[model samples]
Target: MLGRLNHVAIAVPDLEAASVIYRDTLGANLTQPQALPEHGVTVVFIDVGYTKIELLEPLGADSPIAAFLAKNPSGGMHHVCYEVPDIHAARDRLKKQGARILGDGEPKIGAHGKPVIFLHPKDFGGTLIELEQE
Candidate 1:
């Protein structure tokens, strides 16, 4: 059900600082900061050779990223996104196998303007998993 690796998300306390580290230090080309109010994050995407790295900052105090940063003030890896040909099918398969889906178990519009869903971390070895429709 999983396709190629999509972008890996990193929750950062400061998105600009994190973008600079990737842009100046690592010599990576990054996308402009995009505020996603629905998702409660402002994101910047760094383009690597094969995949991308997403830098996320909380849009508000109630943002999930804000909660994540409270636990690790320095910021850290947030989730790994994988592409799937059909998100609905993949979701149903995972659900039948007892995998927990985040939110209302419905696909949301992601950074790439594609349908995406997040799976519970505990079900996948303590690492949050994001499934994006290809």
Candidate 2:
């Protein structure tokens, strides 16, 4: 079962501006921006109760976030991350139930050193899902 609502990923076109919206407009605390060269994105986190919101802005063409935004221009929620004790067990459970995984292998490092994976929205009632073992 899920441990906690870890973070929600939002795909934004501008990381700084989006960070401001959450921090200034919404009054959420934000962390300094960080770049993940592997994923080609710059991200910031805003806490909301036990779960934090992750703002992701693509820094390159290969970024999956950019591709998501291209497909859904008015960029919205990218994924809902649920903290788990065992990501592999969660992955196996989802796969057996016919869930579509975006990546082929094990979980990869997501923002903040958390191991994460995406479950295709098509398989999750139109909501992209992320399982994080943090």
Candidate 3:
């Protein structure tokens, strides 16, 4: 089942710019920034109660977020992440219930460094879905 609202993912052109805005304007405390080389992205986190706010900026042309930005231009909210008690179980249930996963495989380390997977928007009322488990 669901655990908590993990974080809201925002796709931006630059992680540092996003971090500055979130920190200076919104007063969000940012976590140490890191680049996920395997994923081709640089990400930063901002605390939001139990949930966090995640900013994603592609580090390479082939990154999924890069493609996402191509479609969104100025960029916008990318996905909503939900915390699950069990990732494998949640992923399995979502698939059995007809959710189309973005890729065929197991959940992997995502923006927040948590095991995560993306469910196609078609099955989630048009909102891209992200599942994460600690």
Clashes (backbone N, CA, C under 3 Å), per candidate, total 0, 0, 0
What digit string (tens of lDDT, one per residue) describes model 1 on residues 28-105?
899999999989999998888567899999996679888889998999999999999999999999999999999999
Q: Give the best candidate by TM-score.
A: 1
Model 3 scores a TM of 0.89
lDDT of 2 by residue, 37-111 (tens): 898888888877788888888887798787788887766888898988988888888889887888785889877
Top candidate on lDDT is: 1
Q: Please give the CA lDDT of all the candidate structures.
A: 0.92, 0.83, 0.83
Q: Is candidate 1 or candidate 2 better by lDDT?
A: 1
Ranking by lDDT: 1, 2, 3
Give one digit per residue, the lDDT tens place, for model 3 in 1-134. 87778888899987787788899998879988878877877888888788878888898667878888889877799888888888899888887988788877588887656798888888778899888886
Predicted structure 2: lDDT:
0.83
lDDT value, residue 119 of candidate 1? 97
Runs of candidate 1 with Cα error greater than 4 angstroms are none
Q: How close is candidate 1 to the true structure, as a TM-score?
A: 0.96
Give candidate 2 regions above 4 Å deviation. none
TM-score of each: 0.96, 0.89, 0.89
